[model samples]
Target: MPELFHKVLKAFSSMKAGVLLLALLALFSALGSTLLPDSFNHLILFNILIIILFFNLSICTFNRCRRIKRLWGAGTGIIGGLRQWSLIILHIGVILILIGGMINNWFGESATLRLAEGEQALIAQDKSGVGVNIQLEGFEIELYENSMPSQYLSHVSLYKNSKLEQQSTISVNHPLRYEGIKIYQQSYGNLVEVETEGQGQVDSSTVLEGQILEIADSKWQVKVFKYVPDFDLAYGMESKSLQPNNPRVIYSLYQDKVMAGIGAAPLGEKIEIASGYYVEFKGIKPYTVLKVKEDPGLPYAGAGGILFMLGVVLAELKIFSKPGQGNGNRKAVVE
Candidate 1:
């Protein structure tokens, strides 16, 4: 029984066992990447590899710790002790990183929110349930010359239990964090607000272009034909110069299967077509797209990364330094 236990320990602590486990892990990882297997299959493979590596690392670390203890008892000096300790620390850091990755893969959450200025919405966790409230205070789009979008900005406020907790601006490469959730600016779009009035009744609608809306008791079908950020008329043809200085929309109005009018309506302007019936463009608002993420294991991963780097530096220094001069001719051997 004693010999069998010894053999089992030796097998698990051997470098050959570590190498075999690593090779198998690499093979499965490569296959997963190339075949693009289902997410479940990939997860199973990853878990199996992690389990094998975890046991192998535990046994190896235990054996190394015992060996180092014996060396220290035999009066090995400070440098040799430092070298062995650094290697152990490095292995522990790698294990922490793997654990952190597993935790993040299984438990992290992400969602997207589309909000217009002054709009409030509940932030959901994986679309499951509302976790918090977020209000879009403002949205801005920076444009370059020739009217191309350069950057998107969203100023938002976070609320918890109906009380405001934080307010911040998020943009490309700039993120806001609240209670372990990170919010990033993703995209922006234009929205048009339209209102129609007839016969002492008022109807309001908000839509994007290419959408058809019925207002004032379904008698009038309004279709937004085109939207121009900058409207211009040249040579009797409508032209949009692509600058957002003068936003307008070309809309078509129909009443009882007959085209009433087709014309351009500028922002904040009202056009009367048939007596008391009129359409107004209430201007455009920028809607912002935000990506929210929550990963609890990120801090663990960061700490592991820092420790791994420090261990590497310490190990390298010990390796390159003069061997016998440091600590009484005792050399540390790292596997």
Candidate 2:
């Protein structure tokens, strides 16, 4: 039993075993990325491979450390010592990175929050058993030429127990962090509010463009044909433009299956029709989409990355003199 245990340890600590494990891990990772829905069997296989790789890496690093100690004791000089230490650090850094990734995949939390101005929501409602409230103060969008979106910004505030804690504007690539959670601005959209009054009744509905709405107990139905951030008239016909300078909605009124009238109404304006019905296009409200995430292993991954770079730098440092040259003229070889 003792010999068998020793053999198992020796085999796992070998360079060949480490390379084989790495190849298997890469194969499974590629397969997982290409397969849809990620089968349970594949996930189990990948996790098992990771576990084996972890054990193999730990054993190999231990063996290398022991060898380095022996070499240092025998006075193999500083160059050899530095080389061995660099290799050991590189291996340890890779192991930490793998461990960090596993921890993030298994325990991290991610969720999306869609909020209009002055709206608030609780984060991680289904996991972690902690409630963090996030509120949207405002949302802004910058438009470039040709009416394309240049950037999106969301001004947000954090609350704890109904008390304000933090406030910041989060944009793409700029995330807001509070209490271990990061909120990133993901997207934005417009919400249109329409109000109609006819026959001693008032009805209101909030809708998006291209949505059909039925007025309360009336034969008239309205469909939002299109939304124009800037309303214009071209070639004697009403046209919609993308600039948000003057926002308007082009609506189609239908009377029981027959198109009655099509009109362009600006936001906050009331338009009266010949059929004794009045419609008001209330102002548009901006809705912001935010992605919230909490990853406890991010710091570990960051540290591993720094250590990996440092190891590469230290390993390439030339401390040994050439056979015929002195140490004063030693050249550094960077790989």
Candidate 3:
């Protein structure tokens, strides 16, 4: 068992093993990007690979540091000692980066919130399990001379349960953070409001495409299956542009998980789900998609990055030379 353990440790500390681990990580990344529903960070195999890489790095660093200490003790000069120490520091920095990324990927909370102006939606719960919500109070787009959007901003209010907690205006660069949760305005789109009137009950909601909207206390549920900003019926119902020149929606209605009806219509048109049960595309409005995240490892990763740069600079320093090498006359060899 001890011999096997030594063999395992030796393999982990080898450069070839590290290279193979990196290749496997890249393969997992490609698979996740092309086929998986979630990210590579969310995969068990990816995490296992990360753990393996971490151990490999740790062992390599340990062995390298031991060799560096021996070099230092052998009186390799101050410059040589610092150069060797800097290499060790670089190794440590990489290890810290891996650990930090693992912590964030495993424990962080990331969610996207799509909210229209004057609409509130649940952002996410905090570390303490407090439900947080964000309301888009107002939104504006600044246009340039060519009628292009220069910038967009969102005035938002954050609430915990029923109490207002914070209010701020967030944009592409400026993000609002509360209790480690950051909200950034990632994108903007148009929302289609659907109205339902049936059996003496009237309900309405503005929903994004693929969002299920409930009506009449769960008696019926409807979702906009697709929305074309510039619907062109002649081109196989494809959108001509993303400009909303002729907005159209394809919707599906369900009752008890069974499809009751499906219809396609232009904005403000109505379709019957059942006898006297009507659903209509009321109107379109602007909405914002906010990227909400809680990353506890961000600081560690940042610190590790700084340390890595510092190590690079330190390793590049060649301030001193051997006593017999002459003053600035001898060339320094880099290994």
Candidate 4:
């Protein structure tokens, strides 16, 4: 029984075993990404590979450490001891990185936040039902002389439990980090403001592109199907450019859910709906889209990264670059 146990240990600690496990991991990862169904146990298989790789790394590190400690005790010199210990640190760093990545894969989550200017939304809720919210204070877009968008930004204020927190600006590639969550400025678009006034009733509302605007207690509703920034009649309702040079909206008006009229008009153009009811397109308003990601294992992976860099620095500096130093990949490691 003892011999069998030793053989099993030896197999796991072998370099061949490690390489085989890594190959299998890569193979299944590719298969899972391209072909495997999510309902399959590919996740379970991936976790099992992770566990075995962890064990393999642990055993190899233990064996290497034990051999290095023996040499240090027998006076193999300070340089030899330092080199071996550096390798040991590298091995430990790899183990920590693997564990942290697994934890992150299992626990992390992502969601999106969409807010028009002066709009508020709930970003996410924790296990205890405590929610985090953000309000879009303002949005801006910058364009080059050629009429192409150069940059866009969103000024936002965070809130927790109805209490205000600090405000921040988010732009492309610049994310706002608050309360262990990251909010990235993902995209921006225009919202159509619709206003109707008739029979002494004025109702106002906003609608995103390709959405409908309906009036309460009224038979008139309109679906703004498209928005063209640089409207050109010569292009058959297509925009000449993305500069909002001649902003126009194409819409289909409906009465009692039946199509009444279809037309295209510039922003703020009033379209007659009925004898005493009319709807006008207000100015375009910018809305911000944000991507929110929460990953709990970031700290763990960060610590592991520091340790790994420290190990590499130690190996590179070679505090005592004698003939017997540099790495610990000698026959002793195999033995």
Q: In angstroms, give how far residue 262 of model 4 lies from its true place.
A: 9.3
Report the Cα RMSD per candidate: 7.5, 6.5, 5.4, 5.3
Q: Please, what are the lDDT tens digits per residue for candidate 3 over residues 1-335?
A: 99999998898788789889989988888888788734668888888998999898888878877876766676556676677678778768877888888999899878888888888988787667988889999887876776567888999998898799999999989999887778888998777788888776888777777888776645777877878777776765566655668878878788987888876688877777777677888887888888888888888888888888988988777656566633222222122
Residue lDDT tens for model 1, 117-174: 8898887433545467899999877778866778888989988767788889999999
Clashing pairs in 2: none
- Model 1: CA > 4 A from native: 1-44, 47-52, 124-131, 144-150, 191-242, 245-284, 323-331
Clashes of each: 0, 0, 0, 0
TM-score of every candidate: 0.63, 0.69, 0.73, 0.73
lDDT of 2 at 284: 78
Query: Comparing candidate 2 with candidate 4, which one achieves the higher lDDT?
Result: 4
lDDT at 123, model 1: 73
Query: Using alpha carbons, what is the TM-score of model 4?
Result: 0.73
> What would the per-residue lDDT of candidate 4 be over residues 22-117, giving only the tens digit for each residue?
899888877787776432222788888878988998998898888887887777766566666776787788788778867766887677878987
Q: Judging by TM-score, tell me the better candidate of 1 and 2.
A: 2
* Model 3 per-residue lDDT at 327: 26
Give me the candidate number with maximum lDDT.
4
- Give the clashing residue pairs of candidate 3, or none: none
- Between the candidate structures 1 and 3, which one is better when assessed by TM-score? 3
Query: How does model 1 fare in lDDT?
Result: 0.75
